[model samples]
Target chain A: MLIKYSVKTALTGLITNKSRSILTILGIVIAIAAIVLIVSIGQGAKDLILQQIQGLGSKTIVVIPGREPEGPSDFVNVFLDSLKEKDYKLLKNKNNVPGAEDIMPLVISSVKLSYFDETYQATILGGGDDEINNLMARIFDIFPDRGSFFTPQDVSSRASVIVIGDNVREELFGESINPLGEKIKINGRNFRVIGILPSKGQVSFFNFDDMVLAPYTTAQQYILGRKYFDRIIVVAKSEKVIARTVSDIEITLRSSHGITDPDKDDFFVETQADLVERVGFITNILTLFLVTIAAISLLVGGIGIMNIMLVSVTERTKEIGLRKAVGATNKDILRQFLLESVLLTAIGGIVGIALGVALSFVVSLILTYSLGLNWEFTFPLSAAALGLGVSAAVGLVFGIYPARQAAKKTPIDALRYE
Target chain B: MHLIEVKDLEKTYYIDSVQTPALRGVSFKIKEGEFVAIVGPSGSGKSTLLHVLGFLDRHTAGEYHFDGKTINDYSEEEIARVRNKEMGFIFQTFNLLPRTTVLENVKLPLLYSGVKESLWEKKARQVIDSVGLSHRLHHESSQLSGGEIQRVAIARALVNNPRIIFADEPTGNLDSKSGKVIMELIQKLNNDGHTVILITHETYTAKHAERLIRLSDGAIKEDAPVDHRLVAADHFTK
Candidate 1:
């Protein structure tokens, strides 16, 4: 028979039994939709983790105190013994090393701050005049205008000053007025508010927007009555230079602390990429976990397609016989059934991709409005391609046996069938 | 020239190894432009003979020839090709493909013969109109009356302009008036120099054929030209 006739006949045959065709396409739709939705969720999660990692800090290295040996734990206080106040001073003052641009000292102290109606017990960071320079690279992230961090001169004057987190501003001043130059008590002592940050949120175990900043000199003189600054931060020239700078800092700290063995070192130096990769790894594991579950739904959907195609083959057995009797080649019969499957899956794949994109957009919209954080709906093209490819392959893989059975039927027996 | 020759054709149907011979030593020959009808009661192997003649089913043991060449050694595909090229079939049930238009069904034989669709279209329409189905060209087989459906089958059979058209009870399901129209159409095609072979149990239908052959127990018991009385009766009844 002519191919056009085969196509026309098969197409109208589907239309003649519209309900069955719709149900068959629905099976393919569900498979494609599951694939697309799973991949979208996976991509969305990666974006979320990347955003969170960026929120932590850009190109700034974290130097956590490394773990100490178990035996000396009771007496050693190794966190205190390995590095000291002079280490922070050295990093702050030094400039000869390559890949190292600037370092700043951070002194953390838990203090209670009270605004007229509300009080918050927040971690206070006290540092030096260079402390303002220390934050220059980090603060550039918020990318604001009209206000910046306090000046170095303001810090060197031993000024009792402050910079507030975004939430802290809301808690203390409401939305009506700027809190700059207002006085808030830190442990019952008043400090001048120099600048309010640009609402940057929590980062790597600390909420910068919710806390306070003061001059290290004044913090020692009036608050802690101590001169030793706690943690030292080093900002590299750029991300490409961070690894070498971290190693340089490692060597500098080891020599400064008189540590001979690398494993026995008391501090850990890591770049922003290291942090991103760690978080990315966790999210990747989560994506795999979620997609595996989604695969089950796709598998069931594929089986449903196979089942329906089998039923169709059974229904069309006599038709197949008739065509074969009329001089249709076996290949012709195979193409007919295979084309039916491909058409069903292709339609389903398109509809599923559209629905998945719409669903993800709705989810992101809800998150932005309700959670107050923008979670972008990311529909990656690869996800859509995967949906289409997987569904079509499923159709072919599952549509074969029944098609063969139909082709193998003899015309004599088929015609004899009532 | 003889178009078809058959001798000692045998077909055995196996019902769990209990062989029932459907054809036993059946023999016949058809000349060019011959219009012959084979009539026999049920179980007399007339349908089996048609199937064998059409290359639809293989005979268990037989010598069958077409155009002076023995077809027993022809491959199944070659037989099918010959069937497609040299002969056409009409079923008792007017075996037009359901869900297809009159045009599509009529174009079927030419499609199998690989005639270009443009030629198939023109010729199919001409044949369909010749069979008096031009008004129903686009109608599906299900929409057709029994007589109309048979004409559609005849149109399909004649589309290829085959050497012979083999019909099995072409008008059995039609009313007497419609049966007469169908028989008259077949007779007209045969008179126009197209060979035709019909397998039917009705003597009334058999009268339309110039030659009548009777089969009993898978063999031809009698073969002769129709007597004048039967021909007159056939003409007067219609």
Candidate 2:
């Protein structure tokens, strides 16, 4: 009952000093807003990366033809030709690896594409006809914007046909000219353009807008003269069979390479789940760093609350005396002042959370619509709840000193205070 | 039994190892329902004695009793309880909380007294009505006139039905006209069977009580019943 009265009195005190209360609470508002915005943005970023990775089909596993590159020093393994065509054939056969639904072999290298006087350096990706049918058309939203992709007959006969990205097409042929049915030279050999790919700005560090696609057999034998595949993408038959497909590829590759020792394997396999975990780990660290910086401001805000509360107690000495003279115990005075500070911080916290959420929405909009980032709007309920709890804790921790000072006053001296 | 008893009450102040006495071995008694005035010059310790009597301060060496029970033996919490239930104070400044409604000011004491929650607002309203402030119940104390503020203080003092009301120069800050009204209100409380301990320096204000105790230099110089009560009309010309 007394607590209820104390809260009422505390509110009265705050109302009496309207501007001071607002200014005091401003500190907490900024601090809490920073916390909420940072945490929400962090959560949004993590979700965006995870969603992008999942967008490429969660049932697909990527097999890179090298040891797992742990650092920049180990990136040299990406250029090593360890996996052979026999390994791809073995992984593709359903009898040998029943868990595999389909496989697309890829070989990519930087090459210059020329159309008479106009020339542009672009990544030329070599893939089978099944790649455009399965990986490109399904995983990425890569349907031909004009003409059509090379056919299975072209892949089997090593046809000199190429499909160019929108950027490459725009560079070789002007906006008015049609690149379809035209011939482009790759490494001094002429290859007819069979398709023009739709533009995809950037995905997972690879700029699909700046690449060209050609048949793997034609690129290996006629262009680069390389016989090894760069990477293999295997789609599992079903979501439930993804783990089985990973183990099946590992077992088949292990026997195909004549490798018995697990550590000495010349290839690395990664599923969508692994990439999601890695992304989550990275975003968690970023969130923690931002929150730590935000917490410092909250601490400063708590200190401001403490300072104001102390000043309030000092200024209201006679008022304290009047209360004590009217039968208020030390505890009552203490609780009154304490309640005032806690209420201040709590109100500040609630306003901050609201402002943070609004700010997060603005930020997400800017990221998605303005910057074209794959950002999602997310309100982390746990962070909002934590903000409230931390605010109350700040009030409790910083408010106690001034409250104790208020409570310790002797009624005689306090009453005498001018 | 006497409502308040004092024996050789002494209050000494120490500042930087200097001992200055505010109350020097004084003694007094006040019976229930008595309208007693303690009149003294500045530094006479009348306020200190009242503070000690009201349990606002601890006496440094004294035997004190209220209702025949030893007051000095009670803990601070117990004294606070007694003050909440049985004692009320009116300051010279009419120390009502600023920016608060008159009714909230009167309800302040009961808020600390552990009174029934349902009785607080009703009881405060009743006391406010008694002081002819029913219309001003919602007025902020800071906005009230000196006379109205004093009346509100009186209402606050009387809200809990305290056994005794201590008015320390209740009209010290008011004009003679407002001061007279405050004095009559306090006098009316006494006439209505409430014990009143009036502390004042002004002769005219002290004259409202039936008995007067004069003090000088931290000691009681005189204590006796008044032979003739001084009237406010006759004394106001000076």
Per residue, candidate 1 scores C-alpha lDDT tens digits across A1-418 of: 6677666666766777788778777866765666677677777767766777676467777665654434424444356434466676555545534776666666788888877667877777775455456353253343322245565775677777777777777877889977777888876788877777776665545667777777666776677777655656677778788777888788877877789998888876766787788777777787678767876776776777778778887877777765655566667777778767666667778888888777777777887789776477877589888888877777787778777877777666666667
Backbone clash pairs for candidate 1 read A127-A216, A165-A209
Instruction: Write down the lDDT of every candidate, Cα atoms only.
Output: 0.74, 0.86
The global Cα lDDT (0 to 1) of model 2 is 0.86
Q: TM-score for model 1?
A: 0.84
Single out the weakest 10-residue window by summed lDDT for candidate 2 chain B.
Answer: B229-238
Winning model by DockQ: 2
For all candidates, state DockQ relative to the true structure: 0.37, 0.67
- Point to the candidate with the largest TM-score: 2
Give one digit per residue, the lDDT tens place, for model 2 in A1-418: 2777888888988888789888988888998899899999999988877776777778879898888878536656743687778988899888777987778777888998899999999998887654345344555557677888777777878899988888998898979888888999888889999888888776654567798888888888888898888888888889898888888899999999989998888998999888898889889988999999999999999999999999999999999998888888888888898899999999899999999999999999999998988788988788889888888789889999999999999988898998
